[model samples]
Target: MQIPVVLLFLGLLTVPGRSQNAATEQNSATDGANAGEVEEEDPFYKSPVNKLAAAVSNFGYDLYRQQSSRTATANVLLSPFSLATALSGLSLGAGERTEDVISRALFYDLLNKAEVHNTYKDLLTSVTGPEKSMKSASRIILEKRLRVKPGFHSQLEKSYKMRLRALSGNTQLDLQEINNWVRQQTKGRIMRFMKDMPTDVSILLAGAAYFKGTWKTKFDTKKTALQDFHLDEDRTVKVSMMSDPKAILRYGFDSELNCKIAQLPLTEGISAMFFLPTKVTQNMTLIEESLTSEFVHDVDKELKTVHAVLSLPKLKLNYEEALDSTIKETRLQSLFTSPDFTKISAKPIKLSHVQHKAILELSEDGERSTPNPGVNAARLTFPIEYHVDRPFLLVLRDDTTGTLLFIGKILDPRSV
Candidate 1:
């Protein structure tokens, strides 16, 4: 299948008890923090399931925060401690079940929707002593679960079944509602729920993902400049390259096969590596054929260090993907059928609407709206190195898990 990847794919960081204390761990790497460097300490790094979870798109992704405009009240309560423990699985399944087929192929399908909620409720029993923030979160999850009826297909129906307005403009989404809901739920952790929502939104669209992560050792903004990025040898694209003097280094290779792998580390013993063919973007089959957990973790311990410059085209992608096929192929298929869902999904819910509306105001409401609003309009166009004119791949790795969280190959930029 010709997999169409969105450019500018972003991810959210989930922080627990102690924030990600990203003090550079490696002595060889930089000792101090850079301008935009964000210290991210994530316990999910230790989870095997999550290692593959982010990369595996087979399962449905719901952008649910403990609290939000998401009006559903779940009957099941998830204990904070258990939830945290459960989430640790994310890092564990990294390389092995990271693939769509492997990740979604198996599941806890035997459990009915109610059973799922009860299990979550049982886990909530472990939330005896959480901070007030954590307790409030628990209550919200219970409410969210109550709203998750198997019969419910679309979120509006599940939570606000009777509240949808057919006259609602496809483009006019109450962004504030979504944002406020998310901010409260995530405790201001994940911001900007979605930069843009697809206009072709439809039913079965119960969730959206809006995540942003910063490197622990951020590159100095001063060093960031226009660099030549090669999409293909003949096609030279100009892009932004965030460079620093030092970083975690590792030598990776696809022995007896053809691929490129590099262990790029994060602070606090966390790191991520990129694996591709010596020739990427040119012959993508090598990337497709040689991708696996063994392929991912089988980093060549002994390899040469090749000094090179890296330039990544600044890209933002807004994807309009249809998850129907993917969902049916995965474990959620029966949710729509008579045999499995007939009992709970008593409502014949055909996706009436699942449109996502996102807006990029460019400028805050009533500020002079001009490409170059200042007297420096002449100087504005002089430094236009941020133009993204090609395709690229983005992967977010959690060092604790040694897994790639989000993976997307962007061939288009306007979507963002």
Candidate 2:
């Protein structure tokens, strides 16, 4: 599947309440006179689901950073929420030492560990509800005929809504089943998730997600045309570009990163944020490093509403990767080696492979209503021109829960 290239940086603010309160108290004490005034806690930290979302989304950012660093010259797209879900579910089968490794990796150590799974259940429902356009699924595939403990199987399904499967030992049949399950989960939007089954599969983790989002304000089809998209300083490629003369969007320029950030609303409480560097050949390492749940939350709050002449590519992207190597490079290396999974089964087993596939589409389709007159009335003296005509970063997020649904680094629009 062909997918566009874009990079996204989200600031995830997920400090535990106890520590945050302690710091607040210390600051008040230091400031003496300000001690009488109590700062209101951020409502985001009050919800367990939001806390879990921040933790998993942070993992997603780290995963994206690792993958982008390795594939520096390639377009990278990942819907890592599913991967996080799979790993989080897998943790239920881990013993103490292995559990700690997984927990720290997911940043569960920063949350109420006892409520992680339950809160995750709530998060799954909120983000994957029918009203949302995203579909994500995860599964744990064990070695053929492995005896999975009934308790572990039940717990995984009950919390993560994931099922455990023991391979049938028929490579082709196993391949077909895995792909079929993915297709079913994504409502057939993603197909052929796997071409072949890996040999000696002790434990395989699979994750897949598909998103087809519609803009809150539609772009006129008549205005859409082929346009030049800069790949770098000298090279350019033709890509289908959607345009809007008076686009109302949230905008900000980050001096530190040397990038212009624009946010557009999509249906179902979702938003797509783009980070466009001033220069085509500009390195995106700084922007990637700045992504965290906290930072993204701050950006969301700091951006100003404005009018802009907007143009962006119409994209349909598909990305599939064997993430075993990428994951092994992280703290999760132990899982592929001597980690324990006694909770899952008595027989010794280790993680063999991890696979991920993501499909995302953004087009000109949206509600038929015209731009709000009130927004147009307050347009800047010289409306800002926000054109995504160069290599950029994109982040798709769920507004209600602050979940990082998708993050991509688009070096070239023409790359699939």
Off by over 4 Å in 1: 1-203, 245-247, 255-257, 267-272, 289-322, 325-339, 342-345, 350-392, 401-404, 412-416
- For 1-416, candidate 2 gives per-residue lDDT tens digits of 00112222232112111121222333454566465655554688688888788789888988999999999999999999999999999999999999999998898877789999999999999999766679998889999999888999899989987889899999999899999999898888888898889999998999899999988889999999999999988898999999998788888777667888889989888999999998998999888887877667767876667778899999888899999999999989999999999999999999999989988999998965576555533345566889999999999999988999999999887755
Q: How many backbone clashes does candidate 2 have?
A: 26
Number of clashes in every candidate structure? 48, 26
Model 2, global lDDT = 0.84
lDDT leader: 2
TM-score of each: 0.46, 0.90
Local accuracy of candidate 1 as per-residue lDDT tens digits, 333-352: 44224222222223333222
Q: What is the lDDT of residue 90 in candidate 2?
A: 94
Q: Where is the poorest 10-residue window by lDDT in model 1?
A: 12-21
